[model samples]
Target chain A: MTPFDTRGLKRRRFKDKIFTSIVWGLTFSCLLVVFIILFYIFKKGIGSINWALFTQGPKPVGELGGGISNAIVGSLMVVVVAALFAIPMGVSVGIYLADNRGKKWAERVAIAVDVLQGIPSIVIGIVIYIWIVKPVGSFSSLSGSVALAIMMLPPIIKNTEETLVLIPNTLKEASLGLGASYFKTTMKILLPTGIGGIFGGCIIGIARITGEVAPLLFTAFGNPAMVKSIFKPVDTVPKVIFAYASSPYDDWRRIAWGGSLILVVFIILLNAIIKLFERKWKVQF
Target chain B: MKNRWRILENKIFVRWLSISAILTMVLLLMFFLTLLVSSWPAIKANGFSFLWSKNWDPVNSHFGMLPFLIGTLITSFLALLISAPFSIAAALFLGEFYPKGVIPNIFRNVIDLLAAIPSVVYGFWGLYTIAPLISHLQQKMHLQASGLGIFTASIVLSIMLIPYSVSLIRQVISMTPTPLKEAAYALGSTRREVITKVIIPSNISGISAGFLLSLGRALGETMAVTILIGNAPELPHSIFSPSYTMASVIANEFTEAVDEIHTGSLIEIGLLLFVVTTIINLIGRLIIKRAIA
Candidate 1:
């Protein structure tokens, strides 16, 4: 029997050790950056929170000790309104894409959806501003919602399509075989079966729009006071945070940190809820 | 007669539902139409010079997109360059190095949470934390810096993209045929050797797709870039110099612009950004399709 090449094996071992260590180091550093950023945001933001931080509208430039109550409300309004528009359309599109699979129109719609997702949030704001703001002759919450709805569409569509795709074709076919009309089958069987996943998508969409500030730039335009109505200007958490963060005042900066903290906490909560629901109510084939 | 009536009802309902599906395409068409119409004034006035001209003067009525365009390219490419290695390594760690268990699942969850954190938060973090660090580095290196510039923006963008590209690359790496890796192992290959010689080369297309997807995202990224990019319209003299992206310019100026021409010019930049990102995404999809096939 030939002797094994111990030198070659040693070299290979050394090389493997070096490469593995490098990869592990890279992974550690990447995770460390995430932790550090999370830690830093929480550290800065947590200290700035208080009862006043969530109760009152912003104070004037010279004043101190105010909250972004208006922004909080405005964010809820915009996101809820956006969800109303996006959910139905997104789900419908997703259903169409999944049901039609290889059809030419389905392919086209899929491509369009991908392109829509690629469009910048700022560009969507511009388009929606031209569509709604120019016609209305003012920045309004409705315009902001429309822009966010556009932003929300791709995720909902993608997630819904993915979830629906996972459902066995037999379930759909069996429903059709039972003399249920296409719409009825979709409404009763398909959507219900995919509800958990679709709801998860909706949550993701809402979370996505909640922190968006770019698309609201000209559409919602930040309001210092409370939102008067959907037809008027409004403040959102991210917008408020952005405006305040860039300002020269130390108080505003502190408020920005507080707002950041709240926004981050909200997102973290949403993610946790989604994860919990996914674990509890995952749809099985 | 009763059966015919019921069939007609089904047909109508199906057709109606189908319209909603077709509306996705309609929405895309409308988006493009509005962007084109809004951008027409600037397109007509500036002609081809709008693309190449460096001056973006609202006072003089000249709106050149070249600087911001270059800025966007610089930052996106720089982000990809900096983050791609780390993302590949991270993906390799998850897909190859670690066993599928609690520790890897925890790491995956952390990455997902990182991705879910909003861009504005990244922007805020950039403004407060990263920019200062960048400026400190600038001071140490004896270079002019504002901490808010291309370098800082690219750094923030790289961080934002790491989670994205890592998840995508990890998916691709995991999808690689297990038999190929097994074959490599049977040949007395080590884990690192298997990954390098068998896994990555075979999944190169998917890895490239991941990179392109992240690039497309980095191009359109608004809040993070706006907060860190310094938003100067000047052509970037150095990575440390303040610059603007097409998205940031539109975000910063769209609300406050005084003229139709100004708005039109901003919309033109939006059009440019839209076209660029669309092309990038299309290419990414094509590559991904091939990879999957």
Candidate 2:
């Protein structure tokens, strides 16, 4: 090659190198922010995660040491109730969408699901307050579950639909060829085949709502004492974290840290389990 | 008898599926109607002037949403500005430079973890760590800073939104046809040239859709913004000035809004937020659909 061509080549190569380095630098900085946040949480929270954190109720104001057992139970109760309400309906919608892909009504439902997924959790809180809390004349865990259940439906329905869609149509055809009814075909064949993915979706939905604090703020309206009845207001982990972290007391802040750590750990575990499920139970078809 | 039973069960199952499918649309309609009905009092009280008036005195029974509207737009857009570059770079790194391997996988997983961290936890971290840092910086600069303001909240929000754009952009980038890249390379183009000229230009619609979706996320983000934005009611003079957003105001006051007008105004804000986010998301989804098609 001539010298002029060599000069142009060097210039382009240098530009490429500079651009590549910039991309790498920016990417690492983004990753660094993640690590910094993670490290900070673990450092601040490790000292507060003792046995009492899991076993005892919160101490009264001005007290030094207490746990978040009540919050833990409340979170479980709220999230479980949300899952129970969302899973069946979400999965049913999923099956319908998968079965009737191009139908006009099904298409509208699918779009509605997308829109519902995009609605802010805080708005859901307001709607539930007007619909359930105001009508019942009380903030209740049931209202909180309703709010969370709304948030949970999109993910669950999308996952189940996508999973069932991937299963070969031949399976359905063969099941019908065996003279099995549609209900029997769905229950005995389609559901079992897509159970892994459906369960993964449910877990993701649960994880999403578990970390949500907005809807619960006004609906489940926190209580200081542990409450057993779903009609009674309950204090959830996220809600408690919000309450305690904003308070002036150092002890409450510490309890909030403990609660934060518990939530982070639980969500991380849920995500890991999803990955495991995806890998181990991936259908070969 | 067995055949008859199977036929009846089949009919019931199909009917149930259709009803459940329709329930989703019903839920959406209910959300809009409930917000409208609840906010009617405020709409009647304030009328169209509520959209532009700056006054927000609750004691005087006056409520205007302009300041909150401006605050929400500022923070969400500022967050989008801050995160867009980092997300695009990270997406390119993962989708092009390292499409598959241990490193990319780990990076993807870490980003997902970032997304999973509870918003309240992020808010707490911002309150203690980021806010103090900002306060110290402001002190050194001799600026009036409570360390909690639009800028601080935007920083926290940018971090929270990065994972969303990164994941979406990476998917779009990876879906860029292999032949297109090969064609650019065959024409004696370098990797950077191919990216700038071929990949990005071709996939601009999808990339913007990713950003639009992330903007929607930032718009409705409640807990983190509430904790960090200092809850000021007035219009912010600068990024350092504290202000409130539509979502944060609802979160801060809805529970304790004793006055009928106060409660109505808060619900009005929720209605506005719902409409804005819904529009943004619909536009983003439309863009994504077109790009995919």
How much does candidate 2 score in TM-score?
A: 0.98
The reply for model 2, stretches above 4 Å from the true place, is A1-3
Each model's lDDT: 0.88, 0.92
TM-score versus the correct structure, for each prediction: 0.96, 0.98
Backbone clashes under 3 angstroms, per model: 0, 0
lDDT of 1 by residue, A1-285 (tens): 458769889999999999999998999888898899889888999888999999998887799889999999999999999999999888988888888888898888889888888787888888888889988899999899999999999989988888898889899899999998887788888899988888888898888889999999989988888886999989999998888777899999898899988998899899888888787766786
DockQ of 1: 0.73
Expressed as tens digits, the lDDT of each residue in A1-285 for candidate 2 is: 654668888899999999999999999999899999989999889989999998889887777788989889999999999999999999999999999998999889988998899999999999999999998999999999999999999999999998999899899999999999999999999999999999999999999999999999889989878888899999999999999898999888888998999899999999999999888876667
Q: List DockQ for all candidates.
A: 0.73, 0.88
Give the per-residue lDDT of model 2 (tens digit) for B103-175.
8999989888888899999999999998999888888978886999998999999999989899989988988
lDDT of 2 at A165: 94
Candidate 1 lDDT, B1-293, residue by residue in tens: 97888789878767865897778779878878889998898899989989899999998888888999999999999999999889999999898788499998888788777787788889888998889999998999898757999999999899999988998888888888888988999999988889888899999999999899999999999999998999999999899989999889988888779888988999988888888888989888878777766
The candidate that wins on TM-score is: 2
